[model samples]
Target: MRLRNKPWAKEEMSKYPHIVIPNPKECKGNWNKVFGNNQPIYVEVGTGKGQFLSGMGKLYPNINFIGIEKYDSVLVTALERIKETKQENVKFLNEDVENLLEFFADNEIERLFINFTDPWPKKRHEKRRLTSEGFLRLYEQVLKPGGDIHFKTDNQGLFEYSLHSFSKYGMILNNVSLDLHQSDIEGNVMTEYEEKFSKKNMRIYRCEAVYRD
Candidate 1:
């Protein structure tokens, strides 16, 4: 769903400062302090509409969840969902994933989630894919040793590309599913895209990639 430009997105975001970290860099290595507790942190890159992260936050209050969306318009929608749910453990970041290192310290994140990200299908734009080696290296820098990335997508090309990419990086892969809905994967939190695609009988691929540095 292509979102239209919202001239009021930035202003609307200011209304929810508590749910959106005002100065993310200040929290950096001290992310635990942002939530006022030292709980495991989980982050979702390209958190489209906050369904997954907000659900996870509400379900697992012990873990802190942050949703990163680059566009202010898209992020405001996520923030709206968070607001409606009144989810305290979840926060939204209006920033790019490329600058992930600038927000969190080394080994700061426990788990990373990438769901239905842009495939960047063209060969010329391979590097723009979130699962590209460059992003994986960046993920490694922030993820704790043994921490893994959980990815799901309806794009077969992206999933295949990611599988090879993870293997190329020597990441241990497990629980790969070609059709996630048919699998008996319990505790699955549905993202907006997941719900939309699954209803259309579209196959959803998922996998876990552990970076054992």
Candidate 2:
């Protein structure tokens, strides 16, 4: 799934040099000091090519952003963009989101974003999905009380399932949108996956869920 013609992506990626870590043990329990003073940190679970992460990092200099993407192929671009901006407010992690708590301290994050995460549509594979209850607990353990989970996806079934998951976890849902682009919310940045899916006229689902605990 190489996107060679994306010159903008290439140019943006060329700006930042990446520091890839193979050992999750290295980042474990050290992220609190990485971004300097906590600084209202936010993380995107699967930041493909870093489109959303880099975009937001540039816009919000006060809030530190971390793009947690396990795939090197996609993360390379994201790393380059952060370097280009000379943005000190962001970092990229090439690792699975499954063990997120090991890398972050308790209630370390202020917000979590799951932009078009893998749906794992098969009934038998439901638990493996990122929005599953098990994964939500990982998020809950790190997100501060009253912190929010903002998610967007074109997958109807995943969106529906996630709604139930959020409610089941005692998270309040607000600002629900069945069609995001048509909404009046300004500066709603589009991720790489979002742009591709929207071309087919797929309805986008977005919501904010507050972590009660």
Best-fitting candidate, scored by TM-score: 1
Residue ranges of candidate 2 with Cα displaced over 4 Å: 1-24, 27-32
Deviating ranges (above 4 Å) for candidate 1: none
Against the true structure, candidate 1 reaches a TM-score of: 0.98
Residue-wise C-alpha lDDT for candidate 2, range 1-213, written one tens digit per residue: 454554354344444433333454565556656655657889889888878987898889889888788666677777766666777887877778987976787787889999998899899998888888899889988888888999999988999999998999888999889899888667788898888888988789999898875
Q: What is the lDDT of residue 126 in candidate 1?
A: 98
For model 2, what is the alpha-carbon lDDT of residue 30? Answer: 64
- lDDT: which candidate is best? 1
TM per prediction: 0.98, 0.86
Q: Candidate 2 — worst ten consecutive residues by lDDT sum? A: 13-22
- Candidate 1: tens digits of C-alpha lDDT, residues 61-174: 999999998888888888888889888789988889999999999999999999999999999999999999999999999999999999999999999999999999999999
